[model samples]
Target: MPKKERKRLQVVISDEQDALLTRTAYELSSPERLISKSEVVRLAIEKIARELGEGEHLEEYRAILETEEVGEEEA
Candidate 1:
């Protein structure tokens, strides 16, 4: 027989959040899987970081265009 995996730490959630999680899990057909609110929050942070990085690149491009326009006016 295969050995069972050891359990890790436990986390508590509010009743409302627990109900939402259960509904989401069932709707997604992942009822047996364990999902963490922390994991969801972490993923949201990562997505926001990626969007901010893209926005920074756009700002850099805008700065370059403004500098080019200033140089053209001086010529």
Candidate 2:
């Protein structure tokens, strides 16, 4: 089987968010398997997408994202 191309997503997150990701990844890591920040993000995205099923609350999600962006800018 051929390897599939994966898209890259780059975004600037607040220091608090970075810390949380680092901590979560660390806690989820084990001797047999290690979790990374990227993995944590992927897992989070999967969970959110699953919970939002069918995109019924898409607008609410967009509004929250917009509010977070504004809040970051004002900080």
Candidate 3:
């Protein structure tokens, strides 16, 4: 827990996903690279937020038409 105020969150996952997360956390852990199941869930949440633009974490994908126009002008 950092200085920031934290809220407890509860989530439900399938048995398979739970097992996978446990395995991943164990494999990723080390003296220098310690990871936890909670970290995995937080990472997943951040990825989903970026992909869904729940915030401006990532810009909308560039349009193919815009890319083609830029390439034509450069050429």
Best by TM-score: 2
Worst 10 residues of 3 by lDDT: 56-65
TM-score of each: 0.34, 0.75, 0.56
Candidate 1: tens digits of C-alpha lDDT, residues 1-75: 999985555655557767776665455455586656555545545876787687756576678769867866796
Candidate 2 local lDDT, 36-70, one digit each (tens) = 99999999899789868966678888999999989
Sort by lDDT, best first.
2, 3, 1
Q: Give stretches of model 3 more than 4 Å off.
A: 54-75
Worst 10 residues of 2 by lDDT: 50-59
Better of 1 and 2 by lDDT: 2
**Model 3 TM-score?**
0.56
lDDT at 14, model 1:
52
Residue-level lDDT of model 3, residues 1-75, one tens digit each, is: 679887999866557879999998988789899899999888877786777676543434346447656866785
The whole-model lDDT of each prediction reads 0.64, 0.92, 0.75
RMSD of 2: 2.6
TM accuracy, model 2:
0.75
